[model samples]
Target: MIWQIELIILVLVVLFGFGALATKDLLSAAILFGAYSFLLCLLWAIMGAVDVAFTEASVGAGVSTVLIVSAVLRTTRRTDH
Candidate 1:
């Protein structure tokens, strides 16, 4: 049962990772990246690496998302094809 749960989490991480990379909008991408990071943190925690997971949550998902969103705020989400 635990392995099945882990597998589902792993699949989510992969899907979110790809979603982040594939999105054309910067804001969407940034948010997806944050979600990806959060999922990664969850995966790490599930694997018994609580310390690393905490760091990823605080740094990867938290601080980095704020930074990226702020940077986006200063600019625009428009992309010129």
Candidate 2:
């Protein structure tokens, strides 16, 4: 595994994590979380953990993301002053 690629992925994961936490919008946060999960899947693949990578891609990035987005979409976004 190339350290350079891994390092780049790591940086992206951190950025996505912070983005998810910092975003005020629920949909944006969910999307960022999905991206973070995808990045983790890539890292796992690079580390030779194919099974883990597949699970992360399918469950973490795929199903989880969809569920989050759906839930976000169904919720009201109004804020009380």
Q: Which model scores highest in lDDT? A: 2
lDDT of all predictions: 0.91, 0.91
lDDT (Cα, tens digit) per residue for candidate 2, span 1-81: 778988999999999999998887888899999999999999999989999999999999999999998888888542224
Candidate 2: misplaced stretches above 4 Å?
A: 78-81
Worst 10 residues of 1 by lDDT: 72-81
Question: Which prediction has the highest TM-score against the true structure?
Answer: 2
TM per candidate comes to: 0.90, 0.91
* Model 1: lDDT to the true structure: 0.91
lDDT for model 2, please.
0.91
